[model samples]
Target: MGSLTVPACVSTVLLDIEGTTTPITFVKEILFPYIQDNVKEYLQDHWQEEECQEDVQHLRLQAEKDKELEGFVPIPVNEAEIQQIIQGVVDNVHWQMLLDRKTTALKQLQGHMWRAAYASGQVKGEVYADVAPALRKWKEAGIKLYIFSSGSIEAQKLLFGYSIEGALLELFHGHFDTTVGPKVQSESYRKIADHIGCSTESILFLTDITKEAKAAKEAGMNVAVVVRPGNAALTDEEKASYPLVNSFEQITLHPVQ
Candidate 1:
């Protein structure tokens, strides 16, 4: 597709992860599997740590609420034998992941695991070649850049902080996670604009999901649907509804004067 110019009024650019700046494969194939395969070992190793215990407590609470759900996996209480508790937590995590659930309990543990993995060089955050340079250019142009991903804010930081290109956190003005709201909710976009001290019309949101694009548009922000290899296919109607870009290089941002 041809270059797409962002609105001249856009002063802030909000980005989504996974299929937007990073390849979906990295998340599906690398990051998540790292959690599933290693959660048992991670728990065993970090069981004594306060943070790990807190993560387990959260999962336990979430499991309590999920008791009525089919195929719910219960996490054993802390008083249980160490092995049983670890196995319970491990099974619960695997169950949540298999069903593609995005519970905060699941995300919190995953974030900590990913942090260790990234810090240990066992996994590196992957971004498209065009991403870093485009971010740099936008930053130089005085466009405030922020990330809004479903991942926990800590996880988001690890991805960019330990990215293949080295730390890129400096490129962003701030970050937002699902704690603000679900990505497909227009109110979330409005809240982000309010937090950024910008009008909705003066911000641009880029994502691989049409639902999110529609939500941002509903909130009066400029929107773009990002197309990346391994991203889910967009419908023809979606293509017609939003500006599409296969690479960040195709997006030319005109910062507000």
Candidate 2:
């Protein structure tokens, strides 16, 4: 951060979801695994229901689309065909497609149910140890907190609302999802600035990925890339272009007078 230099104008904070607040591996290895483990049961239990069937089928359709694009013919899923979908999930190949609208929405709801599992000691959110303290200090400093993540808004809510350490959702004042735009694109940050009602200069973006930080910086926000373990392994180019911090604790804030 010392090298990249915090802009004097930054006032509010815009953060990423997976690596910034929660661990990436946590989502990939734990949360995703939980959803996969219970997916068949959840789908089976809710197949006939209106709300549930639509979502499950919606995901299947998306999976089919991906397969079709990959040149594999897809089979439609019904009660009898669902087992194959579960097989895809269990194999962990199809699970990455959770980014799709239908699957993403379903994943959001599943996060809520996973809350019970986490609350009952079945799972834990893998936030880095540096997370809680930095969040507390920043909140106390009156840096307005906001979220921008590809994860659906509801999933973001569930994560902080029923986090590993208990509910930390109250720390944030607003949330933005992919509905704004993709994280890698420039427009998403522009829309987020409008939504937050803060000048782009007043917003500081914190993420573990350099590409996102670069995008935010291009959008005129102060950018800090976290270099946490289990975070993305940056390329040499990423290293030169952004200020890097090993942890949130390394972030030093200077108030604009």
Candidate 3:
């Protein structure tokens, strides 16, 4: 693994979940498949609830735009159209999971479904072996930790709260999701830095995605591109452009100024 000295001013760590702290297999093999298998039933069971209806409406709006983009005729949204809309939304959610799209509405709905799964012992979140120890070390060192993932904030909490490492949610100071901005956008990192009351240069952003790492770097944050089993392989050019680490144990932070 490659290494670089963390800047002395760094005081906060922003972590990406899927491939940074957790193995990608847990998402691909467990979470996504669980949602695909359970979502339609979850929707049918909860469709009348206020929050579920709101999310269904949001999915309806997205489905409408999708139909328009595909040149399909627009269906009028009405009480008579409600079941059709719900079914369409369910089909769309399945398709999005197939493609691994990270739209906010989809994530919000997934979080709700995963909430039930976690509560029922049907699924448990999996983090890399190195994550818990690293989190503890960083916390002991007084570096505030935050999660910035495409998952909804609720989903983030559920994952850590029910993680295999056991109720690790309390280890984090805050969480951010697509609600802030897309992970690949530099503006999102800037927003996170401001939200955390830290200078961009004083935060270290860790992710397995090269584009996200580059965006954090462009936002003036210290960035590390992580490499792990089951993560997307980085190109040689990408490897050359960012500091790379294979494990969180390799990360070392200096005291804040």
Candidate 4:
């Protein structure tokens, strides 16, 4: 597809992190592996914490529901059974991460694990070379910037706050997670526009996923598919349907109304 131009009326920019601003490797290679490596240890160490216990309880409930559907007998809640439950929750988390499933519980647990990693300087978030400059330019141009990702809000903040480019968290006005709704749902885009206090037409959403672009477009938001290294390559049809840009340098935002 030919070079795509940003809409002139766009006053807000909603961005996806992985494959859009950040490299896919940073997520799939670094973040996911970190979570998988630390999840069991983190869970064991924090089992007494209220928040950790809550997440474990949620996982247990989900496991029970799954077992019911499979016609398995429920485990009684006893001392020995609680130990089994903890192990079950740990196994379930690892399974979810393996499948890359987006569950609130898993995201929350990952966020907690990442907090220590980020704080300890074991991991720093990665973004494309062009991303920081583009973000700064857009912010200077009066375009409101927001992040919409499947990662929990805490995780989102930690990534940007400890990013390789420094605290880019300041550049973003707000963050959205699955808590707002799933990214593929058009209503999620509409809800983001509402949250930003702008007309859907006045916000530009950038993402690597074609389905996400279609959903944003369906919600009447301007959308552009961001093509980056390690991002899933777009089909010819997808490229034709949505505006596609290889870099943020190609994006041109109009003055805020």
lDDT of model 1, residue 38: 98
For residue 135, give model 2's deviation from the true position in Å: 1.0
- CA lDDT scores, all candidates in order: 0.92, 0.71, 0.85, 0.83
Candidate 2 local lDDT, 1-257, one digit each (tens): 34344556666888887877777888778776687677666656655678665565555665666673533334355645667754543333234534333455456446555766766677755567777787777788777889888877877776777677777889889999888888988778998998888878888898887778878889888888877667768888888887787777777665534
Question: How do all the candidates rank in terms of lDDT, highest first?
Answer: 1, 3, 4, 2
Model 1 C-alpha lDDT versus the unseen true structure: 0.92
Better of 3 and 4 by lDDT: 3
> CA shift at 114, candidate 2, in angstroms?
3.7
Our model 3 lands, by Cα RMSD against the true structure, at 3.0
* Ten-residue stretch with the least lDDT total in model 1: 248-257
Task: Please report how far candidate 4 places residue 75 from its true position, in Å.
Answer: 8.9
Best lDDT goes to which candidate?
A: 1
- Residue 221 alpha-carbon offset, candidate 2, angstroms: 0.7
Q: Please give the range of 10 consecutive residues that has the lowest summed lDDT in model 4.
A: 69-78
Off by over 4 Å in 4: 1-4, 68-78, 81-88
Off by over 4 Å in 1: 255-257
**lDDT, candidate 3, 107-213, per-residue tens:** 77887889999988899989899999989888888999999998788889999999998989999999999889999999999999999987999999999998899
TM of each candidate vs. truth = 0.94, 0.79, 0.85, 0.87
